[model samples]
Target: MSSAPKNEIFTQVVLEVFKVGGLLNIDGDKLTKEFGLTASRWKILGAIMLSDNPVTVPEIGRYMGQSRQAVQRLVDVMAKDGLLTMTENPNHKRAKYIQMTTKAVDIYKQLDMKQVKWAEGLSSDLSTSEMESALKVLKHIAKQISA
Candidate 1:
């Protein structure tokens, strides 16, 4: 691609990312509204669940590109809701390690099933190779943009 077209495509990609992000949030809200959860909360659950070991609010915040205070606030609420539990962080006095409660694990599993089916339907028309290529490009762009 020439410089001109490349720049245009990049700009379009960024705009599309924003558009798709909003739509995803809307769909997520609709999907989890019955459980009184939002997309951001769902994301935190996902991050903690996907971690190899228990994670801290700060770590989850960084993973999700959010603020520690925000993650902590959400964690507090989740804990009260029985969706998560916090234990003392051996490595840090203040930063507690967060883990999902059994309730959260069950919900996460259900959500994962729904997400897989939703994603499959959304990507039905797209080829695997093309989707993978787009993912590669998006990752590259995100890295560059974050840096």
Candidate 2:
């Protein structure tokens, strides 16, 4: 690709990604609110559930590209809300590992079903090939930017 055209495409992709992110956040908030959760809270719960083992607040912050203090405060609230529980981490004395409660597991299952339905409806007009291409491009851009 020519430099000018490539730059223009990059700019357009960046703008579109930002717009998509905003829209997803809006959708997330609406979807999660039905279950007494916000996007952020839901996301934190997902992080713990998705992990193979219990994760620390700092580890979650890194995974979510957020600050440790911010994640810590959110985790505390979630713990208080009975959505998460903290356990002693053998690796770190001060940094406790966070685990999801049974209630959280049930909620996440419901959320996952909702997400599947929402995604299927939203992508009804798009072909699998197109979705794969978009995913590839987005992953490439994410790696580049993160690096």
lDDT score at residue 131, model 2, on the 0-100 scale: 99
Worst 10 residues of 1 by lDDT: 1-10
In the range 48-145, model 1's lDDT, one tens digit per residue, is: 98889889998999899899999999999999999999899889999989999888889888888889998999999999999999999988987997
Alpha-carbon RMSD of each model: 1.7, 1.9
TM-score (all chains, Cα) for each model: 0.92, 0.91
lDDT of 2 by residue, 22-124 (tens): 8998999999998888888888988888888779999899788789999999889988999999999999999998998999889999999999999999999
lDDT of the structure predicted as candidate 2: 0.90
Instruction: Name the regions of candidate 1 deviating beyond 4 angstroms.
Output: 1-5
Residue 30 miss distance in model 2 (angstroms): 0.9
